[model samples]
Target chain A: MKYNAAFNPSGGAAIVGLGMTEMTREYSYSATGLAGIAVKRALDDAGLKKEDIDGLFINAGVTNAISTPLQTSLGFRDLKLLNHMNAAGSTAGQMVQFASLAIQAGMASHVVCVFADDPLKPGTSAGAAYGGTSNRSTGMASLPASYGFFSGANTSYALAARRHMGLYGTTQDQLGAIAVSTRAWATMNPAAMQQKPMTLDDYHGSRWIVEPFHLLDCTLVSNGAVAVIVTASDRARDLKQPPVYIAGMGQGHPGNPRQAGYENEVNTGARIARDTAYSMAGVGPDDIDIRELYDCYTYTTLVTLEDYGFCEKGEGGAFVEDGKLGPGGSHPTNTGGGQLSGYYMWGMTPVSEAVIQTRGQGGERQVQTRDHVLVSTQGGILDWHSTLILSPNADAGTRN
Target chain B: MTNQDQAVRPAPIVDESSKPFFDAAADAVLLLQRCNICHAYLWPFREICTECLSTDLSWAPSTGKGSVHSFVIMHRLFHPAFQEDVPYNLTVVQLDEGPRVTSIIRGTANEDIHVGMSVSANWHDVNGTPLLHFEAF
Candidate 1:
């Protein structure tokens, strides 16, 4: 149960290349097909062939076993490592962390991490696609349904948002600010799903999916896949694409520990994971040039902003209202729209955007300063959390 | 009464740990598991006390009263069973005894229900299957 930091390789790992399929509302390709194409694109982006990938990591909600089909398609003969991680929206960040650890352990030199899903397709139940069978029986399975109180991600998040409002007097206006700002960022990214401008009035006018949550507050359930190639920092320098170093990464579940329902909604697992990531990266919140927070719901982004020390516990409302996260704001966040307006590749959207920005490939929506980027990912009703600090150089954020 | 809507509603499959809870609910009685050692009460039944890890756990009749910790009014039909039940309120009740229970609040419109409002447990007869719900105190 003890982890010795000395065991980790000194050089650190870096994301050498990134690729993803077109973010579509309804994609005709199978999940495996989308994943294979993304993997090949990532390999091509790194200027490497299939033979160059020695490891493979896959995350697709409950269907983590799709690695076999990907390996079959890619024809990876000398694969040295393979792992199937399922941390809900935290999958992308967690997979990248695993890939880094695998390289650091000498288990593999090159790892291709991927996340793909198509929840918008006909007959795709949210439970089957994201909750998994075990997830269905976890929270609200006993009695909530009998009274017509069935559960899902949006409903659960709405409940948490209500608690925050009640506890700290957080207004719908504050939540609207996040939704509005997210759309502004989305409009700048061509890969985003909803690019239309959304103002405070527009957010208020949007219909309610669950009270305390307007339609605009929810994330798009689009069909897409995102992939990234990770290798040793030294090796990444020689690759074709600019390397986004894995400066710091951490994961933890501080809420609901081992329980069924989410014990605490307003505060979440991000608190612990946030500190761990910053400590490992040898950086603080002020050092971050850009933030790609998981925006599965508008409140999610708000809460994470508070948890990660971007603002006070209940001050997220005023912080976002000041236009810090919007275009031309001091702290540019989710420049690629994130899951809110961006393609909902779950957590992979954050990872892809982080890599793109650090490499100076964010086109029109790119941040002014791209030295340090922070990405946060969450899973399962705000229970599981993972955070990553990516930088433009291997020693970008290293402690002196 | 015929259980016409039994198939659509999520039924709690009675098991060794949860049987007593459903049996009590059948009689409109709310039962929660209490640790015989640490005197801690828990929901979503477990064999051992979640607090003390003591196997000596027993069912205790609850006062069936608590306060709203949080709630949400569903505007979307997550499943077909709730097609006609759109806009129903789902709530988390922080029981007086300390454990939180997921239930629905009664006798209040979705707009009226708020956190910290007192709620009391009641029976929800889904076909013949009795389930637990709550009402404003």
Candidate 2:
């Protein structure tokens, strides 16, 4: 129940394991099968038996929200310790943190956090839905008497970006810079959806999915699952690898999904969520060396970096343009090719990279040496969100 | 509210949870937002008004008109269920009463649309009652 201000988690409740199925939308396997494959792999990585897991945290997939895959996966009949934490879209880092907490709290010896998605509706393109999901359910008719919502993720952010551009004089190239650098990072990540190097010319030349957020600025979507395990900090001490602690956690929902011609950062969920996580971890945005943000949309990552306390509220567009989040940059992100470049597996794949980075396992895109990492998770997976800061020390108190 | 009487006006499938919303949509007039302490004109009827952060909201009428603040054309439908509506245009129109509502844009061609254009309310007779869409003036 107590944590030390300097408690290093290098051997505490670390991620002893990780697993992921290939990213694709055309798979015939059920969502459960996908999760099981990933879960088994995570356990294998942890060097633990399936029975060692005592807690369950599930994100069956965004499209699988109302589905039965969460329970059916793992083929578990004799379920023991289960913590059903459902903050959709914020991330796989949340899952890892959930496992870490279950261990720290003694609720379970080891927790298997499984999330997978066939996010792409079958026969459709191999893609994932960005920050928003169409809320229409069958059998119900839309009210015919007045104006209804026609907005989706792109338009939603466009309004905000337009206001930012209008108020702060933000530019298309500032936005374009993010896409360029993100594409550059994606080339390094084989799993990212867009791996080809993108230039400002390519960014400007790309077709617009929504005005301002052209094809290049958008993130790609795919199908895949990423899972991991966290055991008692004591048990982690003897593991084959080092450990990463859940230093902090945060999640959020926009106060208003639409922009009312005003661009106020606090109205957005980033600062609120970031503050809570920082308070929990005792660290500031300047402390972390790496970030695994949800890049379901280009602005998704750009805006989040600002919201996570990395820079002044409106400065995200400028932050990424400077190459700070690229290879060999001060604070790198999506090293394995984010949803933008790599596969779009419901944004959880980035969390796996966070684990790898914290474990110093990122091969080429790896930070020089990651003693600390901040993993941000989000998407339209429930109109939800969350951020988890992981460290090599478990007992270290807050970082801020 | 009865078994035999159900035949006359079939019991609404939506319960206390969805009745108010369906009722407003059925009426063609959007509902005003209400708070636990004050039942005020909260446009875009919601479960709770952000004003008081209270769940005690009641339905009220809203002036169904606004300007098109923003939009999207959904050039393609991600799911086959929406195939017929492919390339449908969606817009965020701020209502006269203040809530910004988004829905399909009608009464205008995609080529004619532009920022700051004036738009008004046009109910879409989707099925049971009028569903709100938009028209540019």
Candidate 3:
């Protein structure tokens, strides 16, 4: 991967604080309320007052809640930078990237990026909440829906996963390996939603939501918010918590033309995001000690590992079949159970865990090495991707 | 419950740009947008050709033949209109013309559908709405 310029933002910014609301299926608070609480908690965690936050970025969830008005609700005034971001599930990493660039460019001294959502209702099933029948069938959108091709992430991801399976001979058991291993790590983390022990048999026995995707393959839906504070790496050293240096950041959006020759399902945007982040961080996949990947589905984890150069592309099935992503495995992926077994807060699910592991705060599930951590966030049906390479050492990446 | 009590599936919202495609569907013909300049085929009815950005486009009849690029058996009902259609296969067919269309694949069991299976389009009407489906050829 070659670049025209030698400029790199690695080690220019750092995350000094982390805050999160309780992950729950049904909570009383609204999305804005959750964001307010998360922001307050983050400010407290960083030992800074609201006035110290010169920048604010908000990422709303599926409900379209939380926006610039959150600053008024949080009583923030005279901010140098504020915007609402939407890259779907990849917004968390994108927010951090923008905040890092802003701080490095002296646009804002301290920036807070927050994401919150309240998708779970009191009595409705998670499927109903996410797969509501409100999709408009008129116009161009109606063509697919008219054929009973309704809008839902499950169906789209299932199609993608099936294509990968057909092309690479990836088996259901390979996907089961990811679900089982992620559950193993979830059991060790008290914060994880599904802490019960899961096995390959249990995964296979789980009810099928879509063919090629069992219920266990899906992620948990929860109502929660997560926020992080970013500032210059030099100032982060004087903060209340250990600074997790933002070593490298990159985003990729592979437009899906949906043509015959386009293989967006088999090949994702993570490949480009990986190259950009790796080039900026000046490190290869072997240098990272922990992987906090966005596991919206078990298949996503497998494909992401392959795209990030952990293994050859078509060999992800065999790579994960040996249980290498579990608690005591060579690659400690989704150490906090990931979105599959852990709480789902979009990209924040992985970003928050990356911060904890980089700070050496993952109590029971923390990896032995805390030097470098790689975090990935994916949005849409393998359309958008963002990568973040975090480290405890401020001088981790090579400065250009 | 009587047939009248059954929930009617939502109709496709049609506008100026998509009216021609739906009009062609009403005639049981699979029509696709093609650029007059670059001769590129476009799906879902677009004003300009994606290949050459040409507004000079026209609707052309297709052979209605394609292969299953990928598919999924939807076990859970996402909409009430699909209450009786649970466990149906929602398939994406790579049309022989070069574009992909997402529709249901009929005349075959859900387990029988696989990638690269040859299929041909099947048009039907439901609640006064024309829908395009595919069947194993």
lDDT of 1 by residue, B9-127 (tens): 76666666677787787788888888889988877767677777899988899898889988888786666677676778888888888788877887898888988999888886776
Query: What is the docking quality class of candidate 1?
Result: acceptable
**In candidate 2, which residue ranges exceed 4 Å CA deviation?**
A1-12, A65-79, A83-85, A120-122, A126-167, A254-267, A381-383, A393-396, B1-37, B46-70, B73-89, B95-98, B103-137
Better of 2 and 3 by DockQ: 3
lDDT of 2 at A150: 31
Per-residue lDDT, model 1, residue B63, is 96
Question: Docking quality tier of candidate 2?
Answer: incorrect
Rank candidates by TM-score, best first: 3, 1, 2
Q: lDDT of each structure? A: 0.80, 0.64, 0.87
Q: Which stretches of candidate 3 lie over 4 Å from their true place?
A: A1-11, B1-3, B9-14, B79-85
Residues A1-400 of candidate 3: C-alpha lDDT, one tens digit per residue = 1111112344388898899998998777999999988888998998888878889999999888889999998898888899999999999999999998988777788899999999887777777667655556567766666656654888889899999987899999999999999999999888889999999999999999888899999999999999999988888888899999988888888777777777767788889898889888899999989999989999999999999999998999999999999988999999999999999999999999999999999998889897889999999999999999999987887642
Highest DockQ, which number? 3
Query: Which candidate number has the best lDDT?
Result: 3
